[model samples]
Target: SAKRSVVSVSALAVGDKLPSDIKLSYFDVEGNMQETTVGSLTKGKKVVFVVVPGAFTPTCSLKHVPGFIDNADKLKAKGVDTIGCVSVNDAFVMDAWAKQLGADGKILMLADGSGTFTKAVGAELDLSDKGLGQRSRVYSMLVEDGVVKVVNNG
Candidate 1:
């Protein structure tokens, strides 16, 4: 018999460098959809990147997102440059959620609409059984200069 080899891939973790070309969408101040890359956001900056399964969900809406919004200033004071909240939803939904939660200026609402960014980071969450389709796994990371220094996933 021939020997078989198995390779295992894992989600983004500490010491991993974020992919530079992974694109995400966001609604700008003028309500225009804007495209940005993770590398661009984390370049030469200390970013607190948060990922939620979906927008407007109970936990995300009531706690996860709000926690970041409420502590935005404190995070900034602790040398955080940007606090980004990313969800597997469209830019429009993300913008609306941001407005509804009063996170308009405090957090950068990022939309991984097509799950491109989520898949790239190996954080895809399959919720098809619940009819929610593909989504992102809940996680938070400290990214600096395009490199992940710390990561927490749930």
Candidate 2:
């Protein structure tokens, strides 16, 4: 059933360029909300962008996010410019979650509060039945210069 749900949601594919005008929010180290675009973050860089269903959720907190946090150094050694964790949550919640998980400076916590980028990439997961409303499907992508090089939807 989970696999079926994932299959039903269309996701970004390899070789696909990230959509423009996609806005994402995040909190800086100073605790200030900053708005950024997908292009700006991925332009001319090798980014490992991971999307989770929600911030602070059990799976994301205990496993998905931790995997990246634990492997941050190794991933960077391999030339990953940035490791970003995106979720359908507000910037404040994302920031708090990052702090709780000790992800500061290790992983960039990106907030897709409006689900704009998720929808643009066709990875929007409808979890209304579970009372989570619209969220992102669990997925990761290797983005190089704004073009998707690899995609893994779990």
| Top candidate by TM-score | 2
Each candidate: what lDDT?
0.90, 0.91
lDDT of 2 by residue, 1-154 (tens): 3554446344688899998579999988888889999999999999998899999999999989999999999999999999999999999999999999999999999999999998898887899999999999998889999999988877
TM values, all candidates: 0.91, 0.93
lDDT of 1 by residue, 33-133 (tens): 89999989999999998899999999889978899999999999999999999998999999999999999889999998999888998988899998999
Displacement of the residue 123 alpha carbon in candidate 1, Å: 0.7
Q: What residue runs in model 1 are displaced by over 4 Å at the alpha carbon?
A: 1-10
Residue 114 in model 2: lDDT: 91
The number of residue pairs in model 1 that clash at the backbone is 0
Largest lDDT belongs to which candidate? Answer: 2
Candidate 2 local Cα displacement, residue 21, angstroms: 1.7
